[model samples]
Target chain A: MIEQSINKEPIIATDNNGIVIDIRGLYKSFGAHNDVLKGVNITVNKGENLVVLGKSGSGKSVTIKCVVGLVAADKGEIKVFGTDITELDDKQLNAIRIRIGFLFQNAALYDSMTVRQNLAFPLKRHSKSLSPKQEEDAIKEALDNVGLAEAIDKMPAELSGGMRKRIGLARTLILKPEIILYDEPTTGLDTITSREISELILAIQKKNKTSSIIITHDMACAKLTADRIVILKDGIIEAEGSYEELEKSDNDWVRSFFI
Target chain B: MVISLKNIFNDAGNVTQFTARFFKEVLKPPYEIKEFIRQCYVIGYRSLPLVGITGFIMGLVLTLQSRPTLAEFGAESWLPGMVALSLIREIAPVITALICAGKISSGIGAELGSMKVTEQIDAMEVSAIDPYKYLVITRILATTLMVPLLVVFADGVGVLGGYAGININSDVNLLNYFSKVLESLDFIDIIPATIKTFFFGFFIGMIGCYKGYTAASGTESVGKAANSAVVAASLTIFVIDMLAVQLTDIFF
Candidate 1:
């Protein structure tokens, strides 16, 4: 394991290679009541599952988006693998981005492509020397991991809601990304499907040994997949603990999420 | 609401800036040759049937409609020369562009707008893919190159229709009718018309792409983008054509 440091004096501690992501005082806003993210801070250790819990508009999604440099912050630092992503140029950002996978709230599958072709996009793009056989194997492996190998030939338009989400996960996983950012992965799913998806997230963590930051309002999803849950409120992390610890908290509002 | 001059100028500035950015990005590395070819096939070759049928009808109808007037003056022999010159010089290119402005522009706009709202474009970006090079540049270039080719196709079919129209009521042979049509058109009539079609294609594609690529998020916004694209592209076609004619008049 790589050595890391936690600076006790400052709010954020980023001088650590072991920390896959270290965000310091991150801030963003879109004319909401307050800044979307005001002086936010977070850290994801190597091979860890960090769940960001918040209400519908509490900027949980925006927080993870900043980690991938998808949503630009008004102020603060976002370091992915010890590299400050906010300062990187387009080419440099793309270089760092390949290592990070983001699953949107709606899946965001390409309407024009089949599942096979959709998975093939990132595979064909980043790795120029991949053979047809190797690509096929990777596609199959990714789909199998997500347990949707049968949906390979189907178009996104033809897939059910859960199936679309699984295919979307397959597309992201095919790249074998080191860090996955899942935004509301189980929002629209049924109770059973949501639990299944949650298990898939856990399976991915153990099998692939990838770090993840999952943002969700689904407490069930948080309980299943989280190693540590951070409650985001008023653009900052209000509470951070294990599921059992945060659930029994004294703060009525923070405890409100549990009930 | 009343139209403000400031809004008009700002709109022009934004479009101009968008067009300039497109030129810069289109020339950059990582050229999407395969996708560009695919777009060319979809935007150009696919549009031929519509333009062809429209061209033929326009020529045949013009010939039939103008016959009575020519008969009154006893100058019916001038029909072939008049229609040929008009079609080649202006009618075919403008009409074909208008057709494409309705079809291709709306398609590009709606496709991109939907992508925007659904976050497919955002997905491409997060996946480390160059969505601008892959989607915007290819579609715009396809439009820029395809519309001119479609106009040429329209011109040929329109003149042929004129020849057939003359044959329908009279004993004019196909060979003689074609020869007379050819005799009336020179490089001057063809060159400026063809040159302007390139501009038509460029603006139609550029406007459509700009509208869609910059579309605000919503399903309703997608339809609006498509409708706006048609209106904007068609209006620009006439603007470009008017400038083309004035310049041609000064030069030729």
Candidate 2:
């Protein structure tokens, strides 16, 4: 089912470097004093799990949001699939957006809709050619991928935190996006649930062969899912390495994250 | 004081921009007919009982209260026609709109405000769905179409309540009372009254949606959205009513 879903997508050609996402000299400021992101540059390969670890208010989420064009940057360039998104109009931006999936911190499911409706919403919008039965199958397959087929009929209000996160992932996966952005995906879950979510992220990367930017402060999640990890501080990428290399780093500030 | 005044102007500018966007998006294709109908049901069908009851009481009390005053002039026979004129021309439309401003406006406000704070609006945007078209346009269109129908319904119900009120004082048959009401009403009276309700409805939906859609990120902002929706909608209704009446007077 996953393979069938993936097969129908129109693949986007990346440049020779296989860079799916590239940001350069990105600068965003909320107001006079609060500079959330300043001169930030990052790159995600075609199929890699790039984890971004940051303290609170370190512009981690803002950086990923800029890549998706959710939050506009005051200055700089954001290239998704080798196209700079800041220059695109709403129609063009939305065309780019459909190929990307976002998993918000709180799942952000439509409260008025059942889990089935939530998963079906994007599919119905972007893939209007699919028959009702095919849509149903897709919803079911996505739910099965997240291991929450039973919660299909439940409302977001009825689901627990972990279940809601899984349902969110299901909704994101239902679209068969080429790149998924996980914003604090495991933030409010218990340790076991966090690990479960982390494992799910890893499994998705392997099965879907998709690039991802997982914005999380959970070191456990980072250690588990990250193919390469970057620590964000003072509105920039302060350190970049594998989880073990970062743990054995000489910098006290970077090592503190390992502790 | 200077900052707060600036904030007010800022809010007004934002609302104006939002309203302009509504006009722009509402014309575009792929219209959300299903969501629009669902909103009509929720905003119109569900509020019937409340508007009906309020209309009934307003008509009945106005009839009963005006009886003594008319009797003092030995013009008690004018009660039915006078009450009909008042309810249809002014009372029913304004009162029904105010009730809706309270019920419908507050509901849309809180619903959208919660959606905003919880990132549902952002979710819709990231999913490549236009939240303005799906959420705001459907609601404003629903209210714009439904509020006038509700006011017409209120006019009918209020007249019925006036009949009941008249029966309490004297033995007046339904046929006689309705004849008097019909005699008192002109085609001109209904047209202006109904036209104004449409304005009332448009603003009610627009204000509620505007407040909720622009809500600050917090749980408390949800309550504030709901509260301010009612206030702004109610105020706008009266302002529109005053203008409508003035225009009607000058033209007719």
Candidate 3:
């Protein structure tokens, strides 16, 4: 599924070192439900694709949500870029989030804004001093990177499903984030389009040298982009290995995903 | 009934907390001035026609409805004074706010609710943008500032509407009607009314934003949010109006 793209490059730079995100003893629950993530522990080395694979309601997305501070863990230590985000206030959490990019399953483009405006939104918000020319160049480069330079003037509603995903990716990339969290990146697309998105995710991970946690049940996506994969079930990590390694596991449940 | 009462109280508490967050966020730096100006244009400028037409019709209808009753006492000559006082003191602000509560509040509620369910608001947060400041503060400020201005315009237009209504059956000139209107009005009548509308505008924006911002994660919740925004804001308008009248009576 990992088709060659024009922008493919090595994911790790010579300067990359140490852990970028380290989660320890993570636990969360909704209301009176049992723990969604019970004693969950994970780590992301610099510039590596760590895919979290789980069935629906297995708390895969919830785990990433906690790292980004979007969903607080009931008990956990989420250290992003060495700072324990669980202890940070909203202002500090925002500061950390500025370095992290999250793509929701829907792509979540601001429907009211044009593609250009959507791409430019974060730049305008975070970097108040950026001149108009700098803003224009950044927006154009982002769309160009996502192969949707022509759709810059169009609204989110006007774009096709694939194009919206591209635009959503472009909007995220415009900020040049250090880490990206993809929530079900290829959930509803056809096989070819899903493959294309998966490849783009690889291209992005390599080109930007970004550490990522790709959350998906899409075996093709996990197989294509994951340097390492973690299988989550029953509120904890069940297995962690490479694609080929996981495929040869003795457990039928884990092997079912490869099949 | 108890469940319904409990839900209402719960909702009220949520809205109060949301408003508190609004104040806290609004004070933070990077105030989103461009977005704020754009909201003023959308919530205030774009709503002029609806507010204008509705205000005109209200004044005309209220004057026409009250004419015969006053005429029975041979107080027909006092119609302009009475209508002007009523329009300035209560009718224009209250009516205009209710109209805005329908137009602007629902619009904000539905817009934000859609953004919420669709994850646009969350997208903003991850993009390092302050969603509360960008979405909530700009809107609440726009509504608070714009609604009073709209009411002032409506008051002026409603007076013209009263003249039109008065001329419908009788031979009252515009200038003469206005003179009577001006003679009937006092600073006491105009000041409190204008001031109270700021509260109306604030609550309208607040309830709408709060409902939309905190809407449950679903499609139906968007519609629920917009509908609830209108209901809650409209009810709050009446409550605030009653309080404003009482406070005015006691103080002025």
Best by TM-score: 2
- Cα displacement (angstroms), candidate 1, residue B99, comes to 0.9
Which stretch of 10 consecutive residues in model 3 chain B shows the poorest summed lDDT?
B122-131
> What is the two-chain DockQ of model 1?
0.83
lDDT of 1 by residue, A67-154 (tens): 7777888899988877888888887788777878889888999999999999988777777667688888888988999899999999
In model 2 chain A, the worst 10-residue window by lDDT is: A2-11
Note the Cα lDDT for every prediction shown. 0.88, 0.92, 0.88
lDDT of 3 by residue, B1-252 (tens): 999999989977887788888887787787778888999999889989998898889779988999999999999999999988989999999999999999999999999999999989988877657788889999999999999999999998888888889989899877888888989988999999999999999999998898899999999999999999999899999999999999998999
Instruction: Give the Å shift of residue B25 in candidate 3.
Output: 3.3
* Best model number under DockQ: 2
Model 1 has fnat of 0.81
What does each candidate score in C-alpha RMSD?
4.7, 1.7, 4.5
Residue-pair clashes per candidate, as listed? 0, 0, 0
- The TM-score obtained by chain A of candidate 2 when compared with the true chain A: 0.95
Q: Candidate 3, clashing residue pairs? A: none
